[model samples]
Target: METKIFAKDQIDEAVALLREGELVAFPTETVYGLGAIATKEESVKNVYKAKGRPSDNPLIVTVSDEKMVERYAKSVPDRAKKLIKHFWPGPLTILLFVKEGSLPTAVTGGLKTVAFRCPDDKLTHDLIAKLGYPIVGPSANTSTKPSPTTAQHVYHDLRGKIAGIIDGGETRVGLESTIVDLSVETPIVLRPGEITPEEISEVLGEEVLINTGKVSDKEIPKAPGMKYRHYAPSAPVVVVDDVNDFAKIDFNDHIGVMALEDELDKIDLPKANKFNLGRNLVDADHNLFSGLRYFDDKKDITQIYVQGFNEGQASLAYMNRLNKAAGGHHF
Candidate 1:
């Protein structure tokens, strides 16, 4: 279980490991992904077992380019094509109907549709290009853990459990990809990410539905990051909706406060170790998990309080991560 750091130049070794049914945690534009050959059943099952993830939680398949989508995916809907044209090699995952027996059943969670995306990172793109096939990747951490944004985060959670990690660098988006279901009549967004719904709506010239709720027993989970209470850190987390409420609430001296840059001064706890996420929503999305991890590392801090954003497309994914990190406690 000695995890090696496959530096950028060493991706060929990473590809070799993937081909041999060993898991490799590699960087993506969105986050570091625990990758295995999408077509290999043993490899895909190892991905789930490594993270202790539920078999029902689906994994997204990463392709080298757009054309490769057709090999595993039955067909890409018009709206998906338009979105991929604009956002491919970026952080958008499109759920398309899967070709029967083309992928390992573990990769799809026994579902008919497969989640696919082309990562923007050169190291990732080149790695997949060399492999010449799809790699099924979920976030490279234990199940329900904060998605790994850096190679160290991957190491922190999965060092001895996985085969190796490709240390391309810290992830750019620092969140999961925006996931949309294109197999159905009207496209539905099962998970929000860096790509906002408004942007998707404008491209398709039609409304995109957001369905981030939990799935039913009778229904299958359409995508990853949808059914689980994911992104939780090791500390106790609470979400404060209003920055103004910071002045009214009482906090201990050892508490760690995660707040927007504009509202850092608003938190009245004199001894609170404040971490500024950023002035706007975009910064919030980028720094949310890192901020949570920051607080988790501080043993002196007992409770970690976070500032929540008002509902909007820009803050949609930010809120989703924060809500889960806070364990659904938002006030």
Candidate 2:
């Protein structure tokens, strides 16, 4: 299970691994992705094996730009086009109806829609264009575990499980992409990431339905980071209803507190460690999982407590990861 870190100049060797129907861990602006040729059934299968991902959980296709988007999808509606004009080369992933014979059934989980995005990262764009195909790029980590934000995180989680590793340094955004489903009349937010529904609505002059935020069977997602346990750490976690409530808890064993920078001074438990995820939602969103990974790695912390953020644009993705990490274990 040895994981090797290849320089950005050596990314072609990683692409060669994908061309050979193997998986490689690489970086995107959002997070590290386990990449495989999206059209190659065997190569896509390797991504699942490498991450131990479930067959039912589908993968997202990463493309170079909007021109490539037309190659795989049957059609991009007007709404989707507007979104593309605004959000491509960023963290937004649009779900389009897959064209016949364009994508393998396994990659879509036998669904009619396929999620695709043009990443903002230079290395990721170069790799996709060089490989000359859309790639199945999922977060580079084991399923239901903390995502790999750094090359070492990938090496630690995916070593021996994949063919190669491309080190592009730490990810810019420590969260996954914002996924919008354009198949419906009103664009539905399937998964929230760095992009917010508010921003989408501002452009379209209408509200986007956020379906992923609800805890219901009908709202179950057809993509990764949905309908499954995710971003969890080894120790048990508790999400506090409010920052003031966090102060009431007694700290006996070494405690780990997950809070905003503003609340850091508010909680005063002795013999404790803290990871301040920034006071602003953007900074918090960008470092949520990496902070979780940091606390999860610390040997002294016995239990982790978290405080919820106010609902807003940047807070959307932050809450998603926190909910998954808390997993209903709120105090």
Instruction: Quote each prediction's TM-score.
Output: 0.95, 0.93
lDDT of each model, Cα atoms only? 0.85, 0.83
lDDT of 1 at 130: 92
Candidate 2 lDDT over residue span 130-182, tens digit each: 99998988999988888888998888788888878888888888899999888
Candidate 1 pairs with clashing backbones: none
- Displacement of residue 242 (Cα, Å) in model 2 is 1.3
Superposed model 2: Cα runs more than 4 Å off: 212-220, 266-272
Candidate 2 C-alpha error for residue 178, in Å: 0.7
RMSD of each: 1.7, 2.2
lDDT of 1 by residue, 164-195 (tens): 99998877788898998888777788888889
